[model samples]
Target: METDSPTIPKRTLADLLFILFLRLVAVSCFWFGLQYWAMLVGYSLVGAGRFDLLSLPWKVASTSLAVLFPVASLGLWLTVSWGPVIWVLAAGGQVLMYGLLPDIFGPNKLIILLHLMVAAVYCIFRLLLWLEKRRHRRQVSVDLP
Candidate 1:
């Protein structure tokens, strides 16, 4: 006999891939957060990376990222709605740091490129999922007639 609980819908391959991607990004976020914390706490391999020695700009960017990345990591790992939102904020922070103020925060072309690529992939997956859902709805409506 079936229980009163509603059945959970199965995740499609696209959904699985999206989740995998998010988890991978979450791992990277965790690493970045760790690095920031290390720098702030004077555990960085390079002495120059330490927070106390850093100038105002570096301190601001590092502290903000140190806080944001891990929170984004948690959200991303869970694959909740807030995950992507936080990720966007964190990534956008990096973009602004490197892209808009390269002199203050050294230019990081690689980071920018990777963020763009990941964002593009996420958008593509979302579009594909929306299309699949729309097609399924049409099919279901036709079958009902």
Candidate 2:
């Protein structure tokens, strides 16, 4: 029985790698979220970083991130479409906080750099996957009568 819908493509090595990367990122997001919570709850080693003592901007930034990162982690761990969107929002928030508003958030060059690198790698992997899919489709069409 022929159907109009195209056959679902089997998962490839690239797909596996992408999923692995997503899971790794999810773990990192979880860790980052935990750290924010620790600071907010006075569990962190630095007493000065506690939420009650934090400045207004820091309070806002920390609270938002404390919520966002773990939610992002859950979505990412599931490997759903919204996962990356949430991750981007969470990461971009930090980028803006530390990269642009350094005076308020302080300079976290390492984190900003890490986010940029992860973004670049994600783009590259997506491009490669797209190209591989396109090539597979072309080959499949050529093989048909």
Candidate 3:
């Protein structure tokens, strides 16, 4: 006679992908925050003239980003559903700031790229969460005895 023990479901590809994406976003946010902090401190000490291209306006922008990104990233990592929305807003704001106020903030090709990348990851993660929830509902419906 053979006895069967319950087995846990293995992690799906989607789960792995979502986890990897989350890690990537977390790391990106950490690095971006560090850069902003450094810029804020450096600008305060050396004056905007030392980095004329990235003047006072750019310093202000960096300080704002440093304050916000870490909060958004932490919220997301803690599995708060609002995290994605915050990230989206931050990214959108940055894009608009870069496009509409280039003169004051200066042009930054890298920032545009970073915003696009973060947006893509946020969308993907949200989709994955939706699918997982749907799957869970279906399982409950079917398992009802």
Candidate 4:
């Protein structure tokens, strides 16, 4: 397909690196928030004397998964071909975490809805990037001839 629309250049390696750094910082902040929430939940459970009944290991594992998500997300975002897979995984994880909230006494429909909304936005961002890449490739091929 031949189109005359101007295409933006794909980011340079240096730009990608800078973006990766920023993503890491953002993800770190996210992890911190998750940890804070986990601590709050843990303390509450302890205060209620339900800590023995609740699985501490499961809670820890959940927190670890939450921390792992941002690192994976940053790596995938930095790699052009893997961005979609990472986004899907991240979104699915968010949904699964939200689903688990009932067990933790954190099942709030509003929170789950908000997570879904964020997932939708993340998907939209990926779609825009894919379109931009396609446009850039097409422009490069046209310029060759």
Instruction: Give the CA lDDT, 0 to 100, for residue 47 in model 2.
Output: 74
Each candidate's root-mean-square deviation in Å?
2.4, 3.2, 5.0, 7.5
- Clashes in model 1: which pairs? none
Residue-level lDDT tens digits of model 2 in 1-145: 5544467557889999999999999999999999999999888966777988999998999999999999999998999988889899999999999999998888999999999998998898899999999999899899999
Q: Looking at model 1, which ten-residue stretch has the lowest summed lDDT?
A: 1-10
Task: Count clashing residue pairs in model 4.
Answer: 0
The lDDT per prediction is 0.88, 0.92, 0.68, 0.54
If the candidates were sorted by their TM-score against the true structure, best first, what order would they fall in?
2, 1, 3, 4
- Tens-digit lDDT string for candidate 1 (1-145): 5554335545779889989999999999999999999988888867768888989988988999999999999999998989888888889989999999999888999999988988998899899989988887798688985
Judged by lDDT, which candidate is best? 2
Candidate 1: C-alpha RMSD to true structure equals 2.4
Clash pairs (backbone) in predicted model 4: none
Query: How many backbone clashes can be found in candidate 3?
Result: 0
Q: Name the lDDT of candidate 3.
A: 0.68
Candidate 4 lDDT, 3-25, residue by residue in tens: 54456444655455545643653
Ranked by lDDT from best down, the candidates are 2, 1, 3, 4
By summed lDDT, the worst window of 10 consecutive residues in model 3 runs over 1-10
Whole-model alpha-carbon lDDT for candidate 4: 0.54
